[model samples]
Target: MSTEAKRPPVPSPSPSPAAAQKRKEKGTPGDNGADAARATELAPTTPGVRRELLHSMLLQRRFEERCAEAYALGKIGGFCHLYIGQEAISTGVMSMIRPDDYVITAYRDHGQALARGVNPRSVMAELFGRQDGCSGGKGGSMHIFDAKTNFLGGHGIVGGHVPIAAGVGFAIKYRRGNQVCVCFFGEAAVNIGAFHEALNLASLWDLPVIFIIENNRYGMGTAISRSTANEDVLVRAKGYRMDGESVDGQDVFAVRECMARAVERARKGKRPTLIEMRTYRFMGHSMSDAVSGTYRTKDELEENMKRDPILLLHNRIFEAGELTEGEMHKLDDEAKAIAQDAWDFADASPEPPLEKLYADVYADTSS
Candidate 1:
């Protein structure tokens, strides 16, 4: 657990229940000093924004919950990774970016695509392998894509998309466009060759991209302490001489504040950043894997769930008077309904036809 072996110390803040309840009392928004600082930095988070955040996170949570059911019912196949606990990071970061901006991530991307405005119906259709899926039913849960929303497809390989994200950033710079590319990946990917290569090139060219490392403590089933010398992924940024920061990934306000700064730096100035978000997944690496304390202890799992991002945000909503309990419950119901509707729509949609087996595979040689 001591990262002093190879890298500088990076602070990883855990979730705080006290912070969510602090704003209701008096002078500051949250009890935690860091949380209060974040609240001030994002002071303009209005009632509408709060509602949207809650709604988006809830929808993601419920959708994944449904995915688990579908997978069990033999409706979906192949690798299916859920984003059940890491919703706040996606929701908060996506809210800060524009439609023109680009977004890309690794396979655990159902929530990321939805946050980027990809229709849940199409996403569910993709999961169900229906013809109307965003990827025409070819790409399953791991490869959901929607170019129309500027959300590049999710790659299956760990660091495969890192270089591609750098290329996207380069394209924006070449065209003199005011858009930033946000590349997301797990902490495990930081050890890969492509990750360092992409960071070095991006920093050298001053490309507009934010390299977000979602450090969920485990890469598949192995914890970070067992994998690499440096436990803190942000310290890797120091080698590339890129500005980097680590934050409490479970806290939405903290994530938003950190991401807001990264976005500004990418959009205005051509500066790339490396962000290490310390979050934890409530479930196992994948549905096929055992989540019942096989590699991790039951106590560890329960302790992390206590800081669930959706519950944290809900507590803040109740504390701040942004929305009444009844209204929040109504929003939660709406989110659940959306997920259910997606399932129904996906069920009704047709399957991919056999005739189009070679569709989009090869180009015309006659030209």
Candidate 2:
């Protein structure tokens, strides 16, 4: 990762109350007119970007919500991890990258995959384990891959994808391309050996890899305070002689700002940077985990909810007097319609043919 001097400080913006109210009601600011407009107004800070971030995040949240329901109804099988609250982290960071840039992450990857522009219908079909899935039904919720979009497969092993991310960065450097590789993992991954080894190699080669640790406070059931001696994940980068910093992952602007610097550094051929996003997950670790009060206290979850990223952005837009309530409703309706279309498509899609399982396996001689 690049050094601190190359990584600029992100500007902090105040949240608006109107945006908060909208977020509380709709789970996103883009669903509210004021919030969407405010996001548009701020587009100048990040050119050519409009309400897509909000729309994409909302799509992810809705898609995952449908998956949860499907899992319950037995329409989808296997371990399903919903990226409900962590939408901003992926959306904010991904907004800064180009289509050619690479993205790799762990099993909690639906949000990242969607943000990277994978077809929602294919993703949904994959969750349904259908032939139309991004992975042709071979990989489920934890393994979505779209080569055209440069989204690598979602790995299942804890911290297993770190080295793969570094390898992608090395490839980019060797090819002499300006592309950067983004490696997204959980805070628990820092304890794994892959994290250390990947960082060491990335730093030594000055590879353009950005290691983003989505520290949602818990590694499965264990909290950061319990699993590791140092809860500040960014501090670990010092050991590898790399630049690292912590950011408010819940805030879209904060994450976007941080990613902009990291992307710039990577494009400039600087070393990798380790960014620890201090965020939380509104849902359980997996579909098996309870969203209500179980592993964590209600108060603890409630406190985190107060800092909702969707609401913060919406309120800022409302306070700026940019959009109307009716407009926000239209956006929400559009997102719902899009999600519904994808679900319907997945429902109607056929499963993979039995022979296909053997066909794509390996090259063979004529019989």
Candidate 3:
């Protein structure tokens, strides 16, 4: 067994009155929608808000697209998971979180790392195994970390980061702080022992954690239905005795609203909540998988593409008279320029020094 799988589960903390109130409020009809709409409205009225979301999503899309190109060119090594179509989940959720909150996700995490404010150049350099890369290039594609931004890490093991997220929440609560931890995992992880163990601990102790399950319907090549008896990922939360719901992951508005509620609840010291985001992956599971695999039909991919989060948000902004087509194009151009600059920065940045390798591995025992 891997070290992650062998790690013992952490115990849950005591419940808070604020968390209980939040749960009671969630039961009210239209509460979730009202909150979501408010979030959409609260989103900065300046053109930059939409532009920023769009730019961030586009940067993620293009960055990964470039990763695919680099993988073919042998510029990047090791396992690479592309977040081609799942940009909205990270961007929308991160928007609702304060900088103090923590973010932890599974190996498919390049996008989450970027959305959490990690520099694209550093992330790319990490992928290139450069010493200056995030994690000192030791983590590579699966282990990006930025303590400054509160992004705990990109855990390579499936379902491995759950307990760590719980620990962060525990720390926040122990210190009498309001910070929340957002744990992102795939639907496949729902069936894992770690998922259940972490959820149970969070609920029983009222830890301030938001469990986000990005249900893209596939765990690697296996579909959700094939691996688990229950296809409704959110329903699993009930077993933990916590509030859980499914949302349209591709819809930025929907995700924003859900995250707001979750974050607010966590901030108030409420027990954890489970959210299953029903999204899809535009590309294969990773750079290694064939684009046209027998596991998934192209028609399915085409159908999901129709609900592209970027296009949906852009059209909504235009329809609401908030932006013009030219403005949208201009935003796209800016995003392209930023992505190019990030790539250039990564390419120009010096690799980590060889001596640095033995530096951060462990604390100094001699002292």
Q: Each model's TM-score, in the order given?
A: 0.91, 0.87, 0.86
Clashes of 2: 6
Residue 235 in candidate 3 has what lDDT?
77
The window of 10 residues in a row where model 1 has the poorest summed lDDT is 6-15
lDDT of 2 at 92: 89
TM-score of 1: 0.91
Model 3 spans with C-alpha error above 4 angstroms? 1-48, 365-367
Candidate 1 clashes between residue pairs 3 or more apart in a chain or in different chains: none
Candidate number of the best lDDT: 1
Ranking by lDDT: 1, 2, 3
Candidate models: Cα lDDT each: 0.84, 0.79, 0.77
lDDT of 2 by residue, 67-120 (tens): 777777787898988887888899888888998899999999999998888999
Each model's number of backbone clashes? 0, 6, 3
Name the TM-score of candidate 2. Answer: 0.87
